[model samples]
Target: MKMLLTVEIPHEPFNSLVRGGKAGEIIGRILEAIKPEAVYFTEQDGMRCGVFLINVENPSDVPAFAEPFFLNFQANCKFRIVMSQEDLQKAGLEELGKKWA
Candidate 1:
């Protein structure tokens, strides 16, 4: 099944994890290593955050991926996982249509 993992992280944790020009590098390495189908980042209420959509061979990978980030990011960070199809419906995402862009 495919899963969409949304992570809310503090700006300091993000800054501490990587340096200038290195966020992309870290994300690239993570994608290459973990092989998530898609990854996205955004700012919310002026806070740094991200979402990762991945196709997994088994259900267990969900917690596996989440744990590391939780441990590393720690302070005030939160993680949420949604099965792609179900979440889109619940959030009325389909109704947004092309406006998602």
Candidate 2:
């Protein structure tokens, strides 16, 4: 399934990493390990954030996607399933609407 992984990293350790010029290196390592299909870095709620789109086979795979940030940055992570337009089109909504209507 396709999933969006949102990560918010607090200031303490992350600030330290930035000061030491290691922030990019750490982020690079995480990106290398997770291998996200698409990744973005931006700010959210006044914190540093990483947004990643990835595909996985099972919920158990959550740890592999999240643990690096958690242990290294004490980051807050969220996962959500997403569907493309093609997936939505194949959902059989018309058939369900006919029955429910």
* Index of the highest-TM-score prediction: 2
Stretches off by above 4 angstroms in model 1 are 20-22, 75-101
Model 1 per-residue lDDT tens digits across residues 1-101: 56666667777666866765565666565567667677788876677677777666676766666665665555243434546566667876656766775
Tens digit per residue, CA lDDT, model 2, 1-101: 99999999999799998999998998899899889999999999999999999997888999999999998899999999999999999999999999999
Model 2 error, position 6 (Å): 0.5
Off by over 4 Å in 2: none
Clashing pairs in 1: none
Error of 1 at 91 (Å): 18
Residue 73 lDDT (model 1): 59
Per-model TM-score versus the true fold: 0.56, 0.95
Model 2 pairs in collision: none
Number of colliding residue pairs in each model: 0, 0
